[model samples]
Target: MSAAPSPAPPRETRQREVISRLLQSAEGPLGVPELHARALNELPRLGVATVYRTLKLLQEQGAAHIVTLDGENLYEASGRGHHHHFSCRQCGRVYTLNTCPVALPAGTVYPGGFVVEAHEVTLYGLCPACAPR
Candidate 1:
């Protein structure tokens, strides 16, 4: 038999570690600029390019995923499990909604035999902090 495949090398660098920690601890998904700015607090010398590269690596490794809101891309750590997102129209902050309201049964089929593999729902409104009483 051929030699066993060698284990993949670790991709975690100081910059990557800082970025990962920020993503993991964030209250919700963050855009690239936001992520970069937050990472600079921990790693002053960190470059935005490094943040983009680290995010790509994380996405490739399935440790992170992207959510598009209001035509902008935001990143969040994976493993949150079957959740959705909400955005505040006033403050432009995105929040994670842990409950799913859609009740589409598994293997949902639509017109033209289209199979629904997955779904994402984004609700738009003012968040609690931004809402007027």
Candidate 2:
């Protein structure tokens, strides 16, 4: 006989738990592979594709946020207040700053017809640990 369909996690509960874990262990944002790797330790049967799908869903639903630059996307739990990123080019590690310093002041002039909803700032350079030896 065919196996019955598996039950889906309740969205609010699953998203909240995911966010809590991501925040508690946050070294920075996590990419899909990293998220999957971490999830494997918790939800062993979770697939990489599922991770990507969940991330996308979270981003769309404003439950999680992503910081992308140079073709890679990094993810973190949302509702932590505004946040920004710092990337260590030497070691290729990504980190989050407590406060964002690079963004322009709100109400700064922009093209008349353009409506800016959100902006992501990614700083590239060596992190303290990755400084030249």
Candidate 3:
């Protein structure tokens, strides 16, 4: 049987537009503070709460992805799945890795009969610009 359709997302607002623009223009995941700061350029009234709420709504709608780095919750635009990310230690820049390095042999199973559904990998290092001259 076909699955039931999901409810439509909430109506768009100026804050949502600002948050969406920031997320889409970002090269990697962004935290609430960063999103709010950048959004202020176009939306001076943008607040942290609005950014958080918009991010939550976007995530629930599968329009964004939540990434956790060092216990920090970050959000990024969706559609870049099945890959990994790279973070520069020197400059604190995050880059997308087009390759996925996870491979499991056939018949592989968890110790408690658990199933592997998905995984994410984050690499840390210096970017080309940040590398030693």
lDDT of 2 by residue, 1-133 (tens): 9999987755565634664476447878877787777777777777777677777777776777766767887788787777778889888888887787766665566788665566667789999998977
Task: Kindly indicate the candidate among 1 and 2 with the higher lDDT.
Answer: 1
Model 2 alpha-carbon drift over 4 Å, by segment: 1-20, 110-119
Task: List the RMSD of every prediction in angstroms.
Answer: 1.9, 7.0, 4.3
Off by over 4 Å in 3: 1-9, 104-115
lDDT of each: 0.90, 0.73, 0.82
The window of 10 residues in a row where model 3 has the poorest summed lDDT is 100-109
Show where candidate 1 strays beyond 4 Å. Answer: 4-7
lDDT of 3 by residue, 1-133 (tens): 9989987768988888778877887878887877788999998877778787888899888889888887888888998757788989998777777787778534667999976667788999898899998
| Model 1 lDDT per residue over 1-133, tens place | 8999998867569988888888898878999999999988888888889899999999988999998887899999999999889989998888889999898766999999999888999999999999999
Ranked by TM-score, top first: 1, 3, 2
Candidates 1 and 3 compared: the better one by lDDT is 1
TM-score of each: 0.89, 0.69, 0.79
